[model samples]
Target: MTSGLDARIRLSRGPVELEVALTAEAGEIIGILGPNGGGKTTTILALAGVLPLEDGHVAVAGGEWEHAGARRLAPEQRSVGLMLADPLLFPHLTALDNVAYGPRSRGSHRTTARERARTELASVGLTEHLGSRPRQLSSGQAARVALARALATDPDLLLLDEPLAALDPETRARTRSDLAARLAPYEGVTVLVTHDPLDALTLADRLVFIEDGRVTQVGTPTEVLREPRTPYVATVVGLNLYAAQSDSSGTLTLVGGARLVTADSTAGSVWATVSPHSVVLHRERPEGSARNAWPMRVSDVTLQGQSARVSLTGPLDLIAEVTLASVASLTVHVGTDLWASVKATEVFTYPR
Candidate 1:
């Protein structure tokens, strides 16, 4: 496959500093997931030529936009389309005119631009609202129009920064589906920046994790879900993560001086991971073959779908996910005493 967008850049502005190397093939969508102030938006701005890189290069469709410290293209000179969290539509223009503006700005004939706009709006399921103004349309409808405007210019790359962040849950779902369908037939590289795990997992071909202005991890969605390298990724993927030191004898020592015996042995510093569901809670110490067990007090309980995630702190701080039925049977509540146990086989240890 041909490369559509390739960038390796470094930028330092006041308190924010970012270094990222990203590459995506034609028709590939790369989702950038991270916490707030993680430089996700800055990376997108650099790609779109809105922010200049202190060093490195950016190339789209084999054409260099910025290279070394000498050559740099203006934002208007790049063949990039950007859709931000806000639709930012022109309040005075109708939806059709707004969609047509991109092509018209590029010197297309007036008739040709309107025809292109009509086609793009239809593709995004906004054909019926073509004459509506920005304020007259619903949030979801405005988002679709914004998407249509972005694609009208036949951009070689698309940058979406939290495109569905403003919509309500139901509207967000419908708009997300529409966005996915509109992107399927596009033969350009796409970069989506979002904090939502569902958006990244469902719409992206690969995922990139950024933390503290640096790229921390990069992999396909399935690969990332199987093994997350950072605490943020672990939390986003709903796994219990602990940083510990492991000896060759399979004893893992946590930062708080708690120890866990694992089936797999490793040396030096390692990261241990276990699913919350794997933790078995008891009202009192129970006789079991499990290698790891500790008396803990329930710290908090949060409902997640049909299960409740119970936070326990005692010998080791951990999260245990149990069904509602189990919560009731165990009388789980904050400040309640309980025993937590996990089999050695369930604890996965890897070198940090």
Candidate 2:
């Protein structure tokens, strides 16, 4: 076996057909992100041997783990560890025992396994809770224990499927930091399947986006942030995206009869995007300098943390994010009429 991963996954379940290509080096983290029922979980399941591939193969570190009908490694036979959204810890067992079980089941001596478990628990900042039962641990602590248990066996590949999906926002943020710290020291390939952009952006070395059983885009976090190829990707990155046809002069006509002026020179079909934070709203048509302005009606106003996302419907339907102070000054509310403006330079266009 070499020191890396290379896999081509193809399978079908009910109405969804999944065909994805994934590759990662040893000790690299790949974040798989997509919408619900978009074959994200299916891809990971195939790698874990829970779902056999109809075609393609799974190879890790120069070892052929699966080759369609030619070969298949059962889940337990493969050196892989899986942690899911639910911790799924044993309710009746102490944290130490729960973690030690992996090493023990794999043939380690009782004392040796317990020692390894102690070290794992301490690495995740759970040394004090070693004797605590699942029922006594908080959601974050239980998740840490589950992660520790997964790492106890020293698998070459680690699979995390929405590992932080079960925690509240604050806990999730803190736990995410802890997870990053723990993963930094592990010398193994990690595949993280998540729907949260923060997790994908902060943790992974690279990102693979799958939608409707197809990879829409793959890039580093910075590259993906600068150029998102699909609407779902745009949504995930918090931008307003549109498919438009552009003329040589840099004017784009959207499919819905709306038009936007951009600074790019790309002609023909292109993807136009605008940051919600770049949009400015006004009570009357008093905008100057901005190249694009339109009369819009507020369809919805949603408060998100310190800012408000205002949905506007006009020549173009758009979401504009503004601070709460601006929300108060504009008195933004449903059915309120307003004018939206955006600078030409703020509009970005790329070949479709």
Candidate 3:
């Protein structure tokens, strides 16, 4: 018997037709990431039984929860827990009662449910705030409480949709750590829907990237990090990616007629990538052993912490990230003409 999640989610809304397959072993966290309106949330909703499937099926732990035109389980009937961006706690209820509500709704005895809530709250490090109401708790504390509530029923599957999206950066980081800790011991399968690459890379055992209502990629974090198939995924992983035709001698010919030299000797169609940090800028033509150097005009410059991302426009538009010190020394800004150089070794190529 199948003892894990196996789903083929298909649904059409307006112009978008979402058909994506999702599978995971028990205790695995599958991260779903994509752009807005890319069917990431729609897939989550379908898994939770909030949206009926137009076709395909949702099966978990050897049981079929949904089968298009055959059978379907209502949201309340499924052993699934859903957490969202908002905590949505009742104002009058204390944290304990809020967590207890889940088991109570499922028909557990009031005393038994409260005891279970206590255990769940303690597991999430919210034991000290059991008596606190929602308004009395900090955002991070409230988020923990929401997580506790979601897991209170001991669900077979958990659905988290942007669970940490509402927190401030500092709070988000801390809460993300807490979430990782809490989920580590959970035996249930978790399907996390997030737009944050960090969340997917850190929390998920596998990642599924849905774009324009179809899954564009699925792999382990390390696999996806090294080679992204689509432009949208390249942006998510922070790489300058290109579709190129390569010769056995390692010459890459881009569609625009521009070329780059790579250390890889892979021939035929391939995807090439260069990290922004691998790009170096010079005010004059760089004189070195670099195989890829071109005169490019800076189209934009955006400061991010100690570094700046310089957008260069030329034969192949590229973004180069450099230290602020280098930026000041080069006097880099929009409209500045500079030579960009990337070593042949920095270009990574993989089968398309």
Candidate 4:
């Protein structure tokens, strides 16, 4: 069976101590999503062996790579490929030579490596540009060549640190699609560190949420998008979640005293997360089995493609996603008063 990459990195610089654990199965793209200073980059550095560990360990392909308790392996000995935001291509080498450099470094003859490099470059649709130097290629082409070079080593693990961040929006989108297709055939673990939700949603099978130098949640893209943990993650995933407390009998109450019955049976402090898309706006209270309703005035509204994102300020400053058709039907302009209904089950509850 194909193996995976497992890592647990803990370190301290001055008073700040960060510890994070990550695992990516074969052919899986695990996204590490977090804000700046959340220790996302630090974790990647530790995995790559650039940063020393204060504690914990790293294992890739079932082989130990680093640990505070064991002998640390050299970065070159680990079968891992890292692609940063910048391509960092050699100015003197052509795209073909750049892709072949990895295999050549590992003792493959120059001729054999170049032949293999041609195949890898072709996979990224860069075969035609093989003879082009870094300055001669477009930004997207350079990015593709860099990716091909990283893959030429046939590493057991791949690390992508915001690989498309350097490209312009148009180029970024096209390159992102190409990168996704190129990664489909690779039978190794991939760890993608990116902040863009669209990138995470498109490239990752599951997302491991990190914040305050710790992991807050880990789940599939849809799962994490549907159910966010902290208010930070809720805001990141564009959902609204509140700290809720409930009794033993399934009677749920919001922290601010809004009463609602939850389908979930739980006790003590818990979390109630609701997606703005699930919030239905009503001119008056609509008839439904939904158990929660709030009267809110529109604070702001922005058109988002075929849908409109409405910001409501009332008991909670929440954003609701509604279709453009509903916008004309409801006439939901600023200062408009409408009822917002959310189902009990739709308001997912989880332990705090």
Best by TM-score: 3
Model 2 ranges off by over 4 Å: none
Per candidate, the number of residue pairs that clash is 0, 1, 0, 0
lDDT of each: 0.92, 0.94, 0.94, 0.86
Name the regions of candidate 1 deviating beyond 4 angstroms.
Answer: 247-249, 265-269
Q: Which structure is stronger by lDDT: 2 or 4? A: 2
lDDT of 1 by residue, 1-352 (tens): 2368889979985677899999999999999999889899999989988889999899999888998688999999899888988999999999999999999999999899999999999999888998999999999999999999999999999999999999999999999999999999999999999999999999999999999889999999998888889989998888988899998988999988999989987788998999998999998887878999999999999998899999999988899999999999999999999999999999998878
User: Which scores higher on lDDT, 3 or 4?
Assistant: 3
State the RMSD for candidate 4. Answer: 3.3
In the range 241-295, model 4's lDDT, one tens digit per residue, is: 8887888766677777776667788788888777888888999977888787888
* Residue 84 of model 1, lDDT score: 87
TM-score, cand. 4 vs. native: 0.85
lDDT of 3 by residue, 61-156 (tens): 889999999999999999998889999998999999999999999999999999999999999898899999999999999999999999999899
Q: Would you give me the overall lDDT of model 2?
A: 0.94
Better of 1 and 3 by lDDT: 3
- Mark the regions of model 4 whose C-alpha exceeds 4 Å error after superposition: 14-16, 247-251, 261-269, 281-291, 295-303, 324-339, 343-346, 350-352
lDDT of 1 at 317: 85
- Per-residue lDDT tens digits for candidate 2, residues 1-352, read 4587789999998767999999898889999999999999999899899999999989887789999989999998888889999999999999999999999989999999999999999999999999999999999999999999999999989999999999999999999999999999888899999999999999999999999999999999998888899989998899999999999998999998999999999999999999999999998895479999999999999999999999999999899999999989998999999999999999998888
Q: Extract clashing residue pairs from model 3.
A: none
TM per model?
A: 0.93, 0.97, 0.98, 0.85
